[model samples]
Target: MSRERLNVQAPVHELIAARWSPRAFDARPVETEKLASCLEAARWAPSCYNDQPWRFLVADRHQEGEAWQRLFDCLSPGNQTWARRAPVLILACAATRFGHNGQPNRWAQYDTGQAMMSLVLQAIALGLAAHQMGGFDAGRVRQAFAIPDEYDLMSVAALGYPGDPAVLDEETRQRELASHQRKPLEEIAFAGRRGLGFMVPDSLGWKAKVGQSACPGTIRISIRTWLKPWSGLGSRAGGCSTWAPAPAPRRCPWPGGAFRWWPPMSLRPRWIGPGGWRSGKGWR
Candidate 1:
């Protein structure tokens, strides 16, 4: 028997299942309105005390070519080598304090994450793909971008359409181009704290069976339009996915298909089944 958990709502499964991380991107430019709409979605995301601490410093790939190059230069030599081809790059940062009250809020990081989530999903909704990188050199980024002392440097994001994964060199094409998967449900969602065994609420039980998944604030977009398809959240899988070129050319010539990078970036094989990866027409 497959025994794979069937507990996730159809929509929730779609969203969680569709999301992926990538290193290769087309050099094609993203339109301004699409970018703005994605940011607007993030702007409306719910926040603690409505602080909305997230701020973005975006370098338009073509217009700010020099600035973009500088940002790329700051990346670890390995990332700089390939990220040069990404169409858009953004620096995600968070304010140090809450807006309503001057009290230092420690939730800025979490709130920023929410905003980025909104950004990524919005990109997905806009027929675009976004890659988030944590393997950056903070000091170099801070120095190269003149990032201030106050805001915490969160992530470097690359945005563009899916591209030919074969563009990666032989060694890298084999290793860094492989797919990634998430942790199992049992290790993430808990009925109680760590070391204390617990079960999930029937209401929240899907997470326990499928590992940590989407938050209530997450939204789902149908293939027909970028608009929100669900009004309320009770645990619905978001039916979302992005398309990439076929992977046959991307497979490693080596065993396990593993290749290496300095602080090797993780690559997730994109989901390409029903309501998953698709082309200009019909659902796959």
Candidate 2:
């Protein structure tokens, strides 16, 4: 059984929530048909303007003599530490120019990411484990593979069956056993404006499980603490309200009787010229 499962905030497809990256991969050769199926899944990924920009350079350890070693050597030492156990290595790349117009395709990398995700998900569905690594010698990969300048080497992936945790060293094994985690939805989802968090109803059964003490003034905290005050205190105070432990005097209003309350400066919604709400910040 897989050691880790997603600690998801809300319900998700079982496949999606079950998929995870593991450093301990069994030394078993993945079937050729399975590899082809994973690639086929990537082939169908939607790209910008229907320009399929993704490409893959595969090396099977069970096949030819030096091909697998070449690919393994291209990986960074830290990645090679565990990735070497996998029976397959794939070099994911993308064409920088649009095939149709030959113009620089800024979306190439983004499209390639989607394609890689498709490949990963397919591998997961096939009862395989795939771990993508950004730590690699791009220059070495290009030189060794004779890659054209038009292609960008995006990432490397190690694919195989899940292996024994005992095969991994203590530190890696510990990480492999750790629970899967993600940022709370309150941190990512936004309301009417940026920085204002859209509170997911408690009925959804989603709550912050991770300690956020390190980031006291983050947008998530600000929004969670301020949204209620903005609506409750602002409306009752005749427009805007400041957060206070005790009742305080009402602050001055804007030009058009718009209530202005003191909240964290970062959480303040931008006031556009009459009838528009603008937020100067961008969400992640």
Candidate 3:
């Protein structure tokens, strides 16, 4: 018999790197406090005009009234089987109008995306997993929850621990149950134009351009680039404002001594010498 090459493996940094959308969930119920924490994390995301326009309708199987069933009814019958095991089912919604400003906000969808990311990361940190579902009928969800016309249903999320994938129905378990892959970073991030390779200054911190939107071509770089050494740690771009850190280290000489090593973990690309960062706005 031939032995399997167990030694051939993807790095853990890459293994934990991928996100899973599990249809099968353990029956273990999540605590309300934990769920609240997840939502609170979402609440802090940065939105265009600082207009946080996301709301969550959370349902748990343990609820006494008909609310649980109501929420479940919102999901397609196909989703009912697997999702029923998810202790918590959350409906993500975004307001169509931007706050009391009354005009339509171009970034509301982007902002909601930022919020959902926050919630997902928080769940991961809490040792919980969440699967964001786009399969549900949005119109049915709106009607079942009595969600108002002002809001648009974004997604349905199933949250809990992982269960045996084997238990899933043959069709679902085989079709989309496997781990998925992310597009290469090169395909995602770009320079001045779609093909241009650009670098971000270490001082400006890390910023991830969101979605499949093309690069903005010529984003205006923030003018005040005095190279504060640790300044980059403070300001991150994208809808990820919540990820920004508070008051960076005091303006000391740049760290890593003479080498000035750029951490590979920094998502932001590197630039030329001092004051070499580029910026613009149009992609998306």
Q: For this target, which candidate reaches the highest TM-score against the unseen true structure?
A: 2
Query: Candidate 3: where is the Cα deviation over 4 Å?
Result: 1-18, 175-177, 197-284
What is the C-alpha lDDT profile of model 3 across 1-284, one tens digit per residue?
A: 11111111111221132234667777778887888889999999998888898988888777623666777777777888788888888888888797767898777777898999889877866767788877788887788778898887898898886666557888876644332344544566787689764443333333222121111111111222222245356443322211101111232222211111112224323331223333322211
Highest lDDT against the true fold, candidate: 2
Cα deviation of 116, candidate 1, in Å: 0.6
Q: TM-score, each model?
A: 0.66, 0.69, 0.62
Total clashing pairs for each candidate: 14, 0, 11
Per-residue CA lDDT of model 1 for 170-195, tens digit only, reads 65554444444345445566565785
Candidate 3 or 2, higher lDDT: 2
Where is the poorest 10-residue window by lDDT in model 3? 1-10
Error of 2 at 12 (Å): 0.7
Ranking by lDDT: 2, 1, 3
